[model samples]
Target: MDWNERYSEPGFTYGTEPNEFVAAVAGRIPPGRILSLAEGEGRNAVYLASRGYQVTGVDGSEVGLRKAQELAAERGVAITTIHADLSTFEIEAEQWDGIIASYCHLPSAIRAPLFRAAVRGLKTGGVFVLEAFSKEQLNYGTGGPQSPDMLMALDELKLELAGLDFVHAVTVERDVREGSKHTGLASVVQLFAVKR
Candidate 1:
């Protein structure tokens, strides 16, 4: 998918509000630095920043990152933005108090290592939150990667992020109306885990 092209459109692709799951669980993360993966348009990052968490958003699309910064400024919240591919972006060990991956879909080859890195990147007692379209999403015709390889599975995620203690983990079909793109009933996996 050409994310740069998609983000270049007139408005925020995923809207300006934080993800519902993220908003619900934001308090679980200790106050400190947070790293947001695939943080397109800065919605989640800006929300966390507004809640007093230092936030850094990373995305492969420079255009998206630019809009993220603009949104942050517009929201009167400061959020750092990084333009880099998730597959190659380094997650420093024990550096983040929280790491979030909302709708960040990538092939397993890239996602597996990235998830492992996320596990190592969190400080002890830190939280890691994720919400992604499940493999079953193809049946819903909702927003998500069409490729099955890019969709996630709950059991697979548990294995990938093994060291953390799961606070919440489940697969559910629910209505998701985030923006112009993500709207409809969707199958998704949500995870909230804390580093031991």
Candidate 2:
């Protein structure tokens, strides 16, 4: 997907509001540096910054990151933005108090290593929060990658994120109203895990 082109459009592709799950789970994360992966437009990062977490948002699209910075500025909060692809973006070990991967869908080759790095990147007791479309989402057509390989499975994630002590993990159909792209009832996997 040409994220740059998508983001280059008039408004935020996923809206300016943080994901509902992210907002709901933010209080569980320790207050400190937070890393946001595939952070397309900085809604979540900006929201976290507003809550006093030092946020760093990383994304593949320069246009998206630019808009993210603008959003942060508009919100009167500061957040670092990094433009890099997930395949090559390095998640420094023991560097984050929290890490978020909301709606970040990628093929297994990239997703596997990225998820492993996310596990290693957190400090002990640091939390990892993720909410993404599940394989069942293909039937919903609300949003997310069309390819099944890009959709996540709860069991698969459990194996991929082995070191974390899961606080919550499940796949269910829920209403996801997020901008123009994602709307209506959708199938998704939500997870909140603490690094052991």
Candidate 3:
């Protein structure tokens, strides 16, 4: 299904709350500008902005970003939204203090270079946070891509983010309640890395 089509519907696709892991670890993040990858509907970016972090949300769908902008406005927080494909989106080297990728899955060819870009985008001491469906998630059928190639593994993520120090990396089975699409038990790989 087209992402724009899905996002154009009424209400937020992923609901208004940030990811569970993101909310849990928000305190550990350093105060600075943050970039949220594939930040559909701006939930995470708006949350970060509410906490005084300068936030930018990038997504491929203009419709989704429009909703993000609306959400930001409703919450009285500011979030810059960018409409671009992750496969080609580029960020200046060391341009960001923090980078977040929540459920932004892609095929290996596209995901690899995007990860490289993410590493380069982080400044020294910058944090890189990620949460994505694991290959095992196909069995759960809660949400996320069905193909295994679109899913992530811990070791693979480590290699992709080799430029950063691994603060935390694990694959776990957890309950994900994000709107109607992403709800129920899910297998996911979560990462928290820092550039040094």
Candidate 4:
């Protein structure tokens, strides 16, 4: 199935609220321009917008982007969205205060360049938050890309973000409720880091 089709079902795939980990640190994230990677249906983007953050959401699927806008309207928040393939999207340097990559799954080969772009997109001291499935997720059959190459662990993220200052990085098992697709005990790596 197409990426948008995977997310374009009747309900939100990851729910209509900000992620719990995101909510926990929401207070610390100073309001400013924010970019959300692979923002399927815009739950986090809309939530951030509601909290006074200027959010820019990017995704490849128009179907998903439209749903994201709908969610923003339903919540009475404003968010900027762009439909573009992250694989080749050129993220401007020093352009954002914060970036969020929540459950973005891609082959490692594809992930590297995209991740590098995510890092480069941030200004110095800008924060980047990521919560994604670990390879161990294959055991749980939870909500994540089934491909092992698409999953990640702390060690991998450490290597991928070699130059960043890590505020938090750990593998945690948590109950995730994101629409009907991402729910259950998810083995995830949560990282809060900043560019040097």
- How many residue pairs clash per model? 0, 0, 0, 4
3 versus 4: better TM-score goes to: 3
Please give the RMSD to the true structure for each candidate, in Å.
0.6, 0.6, 0.8, 1.2
**What pairs collide in candidate 2?**
none
Whole-model lDDT, candidate 3? 0.90
Off by over 4 Å in 1: none
- Candidate 2 lDDT by residue in tens digits, 86-196: 999999999999999999999999999999999999999999999999999999889999999999999999988889999999998999999899999999999999998
- Misplaced by over 4 Å in model 4 are none
lDDT of 3 by residue, 1-196 (tens): 5899999888888999999888877777889889999998888998989989999999999999999999999999889999999889998898898999999988989988999888999989899999999989988979999889999998888888888999889999999999989989899999889999
RMSD of 4: 1.2
Q: Write the per-residue lDDT of candidate 1 for residues 1-196, one digit (tens) a residue.
A: 8999999999998999999999999998999999999998899999999999999999999999999999989989999999999989999999999999999999999999999999999999999999999999999998899999999998889988999999999999989999899999999999999999
Residue 97 CA displacement from its true place in model 4, Å = 0.5
Give me the displacement of residue 61 in model 1, in angstroms: 0.5
Q: Roughly what TM-score does model 1 have, to 2 decimal places?
A: 0.99
lDDT of 4 by residue, 1-196 (tens): 3978877678877788878887777766656999999998888899899889999999998988999999999999899999998878888988988989888887888788878877888888788899888888888887788888899988878877677799898898888877787779989889999887
Better of 1 and 4 by lDDT: 1
